[model samples]
Structure formats: C-alpha cells, structure tokens
Target: MAPQLTSLYTTSFLIALFVTLLVAACLRAINILPGRTCHSAKAPRKAAPATRILIVLGSGGHTHEMFHLLRDLDTSRYTQRTYIVSGGDAFSAQRAVEFEQTLEDRASETRNKATTVRRRGTERPLCVGAEHFNIATIPRARKIHQSLLTTPFTSLVTLVSAFSPLFRSDRLHPNLPPTTPYEIAAQDLPDLIITNGPATGVIVVLAALIAKFFNLKGCSSRSKCRTIYVESFARVKTLSLSAKLLAGVVDRFLVQWEELEGEGGYVGGHAEYWGILV
Candidate 1:
C-alpha cells in the first residue's frame, strides 16, 4: 500500500508539473505575440543612428522577389546587412554578392558627384563594401522529397541553428572595437528581419520569437528582431503556406493583392495590403 501510494503521488506531481509548464508557455505567448493593430511600435524610430537588417533569402522565386523589394534600400541608415541563406543554395548567396556590388557602384557614382560639387569637406562613409555585409547559411527545415517523419527532426535542428545568427557573433567582427557603429551593429541584435514565403524564413522568424519570449540578449526589452513578412506577389487571392503559418507571428504581414488584405483573421493579426511591394 505504501509503495502504491508513493507511485500515485509521483504520477500526480508529474502531471501537475506538465500542466504548470503548459500554462506558463501559453501566458508567455499571449504577452509577446503582436496584435492586429500593434505594428508601428515594433519598428525602429527614425532617430536611430545605425540599424542592422537581416534578410532571409530562399531559392528561385522567393529570392527573386526579395531583391526587388529591397531595390530602394538605403545603405546609409541601414549600416549593416546580414543575408541568411539555406545550406546548398549557391544561387542566393551569389545574388546577395551581386546586389552588394551594385550598391558599391552606386556609392562610387554618388561619391564622384559629391567630390565634383565640393572637394574640401569629408563625405560620410557608405556601408556598401564586404565588411558592411555578411551572408549566413542555415540548414533547410524541410527539403524536397524529404520524409514527413524526418521533417520534424530536421526542422527542430533548423530552429536551434537559427538562433546563432540572430545573436551577435564575434567571429564576424574579429579585432574590431565594439564602439564603432559597424561593430556595434554586429555585436547587437538585428533591428529588422525581412522575409518572403520560404521554409527557412519561417524557422528563422520562429527562432526570433523564441528569443524575444525569453528576452534573449534583451531582444524584447530592446525591441529588436522585429520581423516583416511579405507575401509573394504571385498569390492574388490566398495566402501561401508560409504566410498562413507566420501571419500572426511576424510584426508586419504585407500582401501585394487586395483580396488577401485580411486573410489571417483567424489568427491575431490580419494581412496588410501595401499595393505590390515586389
């Protein structure tokens, strides 16, 4: 009777512990998740001197659309750019390099014009070179023709790996003083994370949410890792699988078509139509 009572008490304690943990997780999700109208506050204010932006790129169409959206990116304000690509995607990595090259060329032309205007004063530096940008590679959460049973395991691995790039990595800025704006951007959390519909993108954003939930590296306290998810322009009436999963999780959910403006009503927030961002 004594042994049986002890076993029963152990079972009860285990059940109580599980319930407590479940409740705590629910409460945390409620506190940190963004609401329908709570979008503007998550963004960095104009007064910020330097901001780091992380861009998640996927293969093929997703990669093509992302660069188009960032065609007007201002290198002066967004001092540091981090491009996250999935493993084995050389095309996306190459595209990022080409994009930076274009920025460099544009900067050179602007500098030449500035020099012609006035040769005496020093011009503010442009963040276009290799030092100002980095490309990080993470494993794909789900691969083509992958087994469903193994997908969850792969995705779990991806979720864990995603945190490495979100936080500051000293390897990327070796021997540099932390006081400089570029180094500071490297040492701190990203101000913004931009993504389109990609499996890797969803995992990366999820990792950011997890970090914010625990206030990892002051992510939530400092209001960093704010995400903007743009639905693919190809989707006119319906949201893609990735968009459906992340509509509520991302800080801003943008859809190009009017029909998908309020698509995520079932979730906390709704899709915002910005009129063909891509």
Candidate 2:
C-alpha cells in the first residue's frame, strides 16, 4: 500500500508539471502576438513624418517629474508632442506652455547654430501658439482621497472623455478638410505615453489599452501607443492606490522605490525599480 501511494503521488506531480509547462508555452506565444485582428505582426511599419508623444501631467510632483523627463527627451526624435491634464488644471497648462516654448527655443538655437542642418535650411519647430504641441484636458476622474466606490461611475465617464482628444480636430488646421478624430488619431496617435500616478493617468492608460484592443484610432499597435507608468517618488514602502490599480495594465510599470519592487500580485510578474524618476 505504501509503494502504491508513492507511485500515485509521483505520477500526479509529473502531470501537474507537464500541464504547467504547456500553459506557460501557450502564454508566451500569446504575449508575443501583437494586436490588430487582421494585422500581421511581421509586417514592416511605415515611419510617419514625426513620432508623436503624449505625456500626462498629474498636478504637482507628477508635473515636475514629467517636465524633467520631457526636457531630456530627444526632441529631434519627436516631431509633435501632446500634454494631457485634468480639466481646471491651470497650473499644468501653464507649465506645459512654458516648458514647450523652452524646448522650441532650445531646438531653434541648435538649428540656427548648426553648421550642417542649417546649411540645408531645415526649418525648426515654431514656438508659435504651440502648433507642434497641444494641451488636451479631460475632466478629473474623481477628487483625490475620495472613496473608491464613487470612482467607477466617474471613471467610466472619464474613460469615454479620455478618447475625445484622440478624435478631436486640430483647431489649428482649419484650412485642412474636416477630419474625424478617429482618422486623425489613427494616423497620428502617440507612439509613447508617459505618466505618474493619478486618477487621470489611470483613465488615460485604460483608454489607450482599450483602443489598442479594439484596434481603434490606429493606436492598436503597442509600438504606437505604449504606456509607461512611473510610481510616485513619494511612495516609500508600498505602492500608491493609483499605481496598484494600473500595475496590471500598463506596458511598463516602474516603481520609484526599491523596497516596493517585489510586491506580490503584480500582473507583469515584476516591476522595474528605477530610482526616483524626479
């Protein structure tokens, strides 16, 4: 009887091991498969005129982190940039205006002084009224520290409004024919999205993921609409509520604190611990 029991246990262990391996293999294949119902992951993508980027600004510290990150980004690599902020956030809008103009001026000086590119008369991005940049506002998902229950309804409403900017016509180009937001967003949706914790980040990130899932607004490709969520520097030992909620969905989840790096239940299995984004 003892021998029989040992043999049964061994057999069961082998079956479980085999099942686990098979499941892991299947999941790996699915992970590599890019989105788009009829799209081929192997197909070559056409490079657009310029790479578009969207940066979400959360009121105070988040805005500071983003501003520093934005300043360092190779502006030459990004032709157009968009800043997303919650409605009534005049501070964020003001920061964006000031920061974008600074960027423009810096790039212009580089161009004006360049012995190579300027010889070819390559035009620099204009500082004028932020033509190459836009400030998009969506209603706040819910006020800070509010109960989680009230959020679902507000979050749902915020989710729909989050997509509005992607569909909005560039009021700048009135001479251009009337264009649907989907068409415009599909053609020029951001290739990269950066954000720190906030209800605003949660909504926008979810919207981007949903858009990619449905292959709507041409942001279906992860390469075209990748989301990077950086946990707040203020978080020391544990993740903030916003980061915890977004950990499962965002493409890259970065934690500012090293101690919280190995928190359990992270959907990606691990979080990259990049010390202090600010």
What TM-score does candidate 1 get on C-alpha atoms? 0.89
Model 2, which residues run further than 4 Å from truth? 1-48, 116-129, 144-149, 167-169, 178-187
Q: For candidate 2, write residues 33-75 as lDDT tens digits.
A: 3323212234576544456678888887789877876666666
The local distance difference test score of each candidate is: 0.86, 0.69
The TM-score between candidate 2 and the true structure equals 0.72
Model 1 clashing residue pairs (backbone): none
RMSD in Å for model 1: 3.6
True-vs-predicted CA distance for residue 141, candidate 1, Å: 1.7
Q: Which candidate is the best by lDDT?
A: 1
Q: Which numbered prediction scores highest in TM-score against the true structure?
A: 1
